[model samples]
Target: MPGPVSLAEQVKEVWTSDEGSMAKDTASNRWPKIVQGMVDDVAETAATAVDRPQQEEALSIQAALKEIKDDMLQNRVLRPLPSDGRDDIDGYNERLEQLGGKCTWLACPWLFGECYLYRRVQTIFALTHHWRDYDIFKRQKDSTFAKSCKAVEELSARYMQVIANSTLPGDATNEEARKLLFVEMTEVALWGNATDLSLLSNLSLDQIQSLQGREAIAKSQRNIVDNDTDAVWQYLSSPLRFNRRIDIVLDNAGFEFFTDVIYAAYLLESGLASVIVFHVKDFPWFVSDVIAADVESLFQHLESASIFPNRSFIDQVVPRLRAHFDSGAMSIKQHSFWTTAYSFHQMKALAPGLFKSLQVSSMVIFKGDLNYRKLTKDGLWPHTTPFKDAIGSMGAESGIKVLALRTNKSDTCVGVESQERVDALNEEAPHGVWIRNGKYAVVSFSDGEKTDGK
Candidate 1:
């Protein structure tokens, strides 16, 4: 007989019936809509196919995607992934097998269920000959990026000023200036995640603009109940941080990615880091998660004459980005571990190499809600739990300097001061709104200390 579920396993389970739960809403409402949209995108591809073979493959993929949506709606048992030559397939299937008969879309852990849906969607395209490399989420990603041009232009002007003025290789002369710039750029990057495509799907151009810009950013400062601005800045700006290498496990593409790039540029320019390594998803993921192609595509958009009217800003910024790539100051890395269903706490055992590589970095910045969820294990941690304690192995014991920047959009939250503040916020809003509204944020940081649990 299967062993009784451990306390750890019990916390991992995020059932769809939990009242006022994002997991429940996602499994029931959000997922079907997402999968059906993929079916529509695939149908469009099928109709536009140049040949019969391509059309046939597209139709098959569409059917498979539709089936996924139906399964979610029907709450069918979660199945092991079909063998697809991918290295991570076994790990996913094994996870399902371990669950025995209790696994289903609305009944399994929220984190695993969400990952399975995306991977299953990717599998449909993987099995096809003609559409194997096709990105079903490409249209939506590009469209959203295009829609965020105003914010893009606004940020461009702000970022270019810093790039044009700052010194590189050494900038210790103006300590206060560097510190202020770091705070501004980092905050810009933190809140950029408010527009994650997986949540807030129906945001208009005006709403997008409202979430960005200097005025909007300044206004959102009060919403950051848990602040680590000083802690992160003090560490990054410290004289001890020579030869710094910053790794940003990225979130959304387009506008958010642009903000991240700007933040990276500030680090490189102010001599904060010698190099920046961006971590991207190996496959298309979570609607807008950074894939390899999106990075290049963003630069193309940056250089576009019609999309952005500020040629002077574009001329200054675009080539600088290219230079970073050319000079090896900035690079992109992709590992399949990022797209897996497992929490980052399991990284030590599951993806030892990736975990080891990250240990050498100055700091690893996890952007957006999903990465934050993975870091914190997406569990029912009390709102008052310390951020360091919430991340388990990814915390102080692992000796990884970790910074998680996310606008809240789910149930798992920690690192706030007290239960009183949480109670006050809840009283002012609808139930569960304070935690998942995407209006509030947390900038939590931890050091690489094993001795005292820094």
Candidate 2:
């Protein structure tokens, strides 16, 4: 796990005037102050949220939004300062305004108002409301992750049904079984949305898969217990297999880590991998994106399970994971792949070798929402765009099985079919509410389309 630099540290860096072709403004002098003021407002608001609770928190969040709107209007943030034509500061500014408006909508308790990032960004803009603002963030806040969550639930139920029949076609030692297992595994990989929120709730994979029977939930829990993940277990239990390594493209660190650990434990128990590597960003990324420090935070939470309201459940799962970590079934390593400077395209240029290195691994899981956004390039493609097409060249070329399980957050999306479905969703849903609500999702997969004739 990586640690994020303090807000003060980030302020020092972004606030320093820099002049270059890529600089947002042609002149550096004025930009730094404007950027710093916004940063200061955010920092202050974070402090207020932390210090205050209950009713007071709402005011703090609103105050932060006001600061962003004010800065945008006063600083001419809507206008591009100066950059190569390739970089759209103006478009980005407009997007930010839209994003800010969406945040304001997220403040509504009736929606995903509890989401920290949405609330924080909303705070920044609610105080500044741009005249042309179309409540972009509001549209997003109402939609986003909601779709994926529903999709995963549906898929989980389907998987559970298949598993229950015992006629799942892949259970036998027959050749046909092997093939079916491969498809099942691939499906599992597909659902690896690296950022889906379903796992965070009680919606575990087994539960999703066993969505039948009067005791479906209990059955899922049982499956979690009875499943002999020794092979995957061995890898996760003692991941450094003398020569093997595993890589985890991380997501959010807190409770999300718990779900990830459960999966890691399964991989280790099943003998699917060895050596766990975690990739993280070098800076404060996408608001609550995981940095390395989250590892410790996760450990503390697991260690003191008694403190959690769901202590009994925690007690059952935490020990298995701890045993794996303690026994060296797992090891954690980090890389700064999630920074603003390294677009997926840029990653191709700068770290082709690193990705190539990862290609050798038995499995690599990219976690969480930001990675999904980056993978898809945050475009305005039609909802039905194929997942592979949206990810462009990088996703297609990698000789790895890339599975993306993401609840929608940004504008770019894929996996839906029909303009009618999209229009119906838009008409029935509120504003740009689809993206923010997490109602849509994509269990996208790409096999790295190896054309080398291996």
TM-score of 2: 0.52
lDDT value for candidate 2? 0.44
lDDT of 1 at 4: 84
Off by over 4 Å in 2: 1-70, 73-170, 173-246, 417-432, 450-454
The 10 consecutive residues of candidate 2 with the worst lDDT sum are: 105-114
Task: TM-score each candidate.
Answer: 0.90, 0.52
Name the runs in model 1 displaced over 4 angstroms.
1-13, 164-174, 194-219, 451-454
lDDT of each: 0.80, 0.44
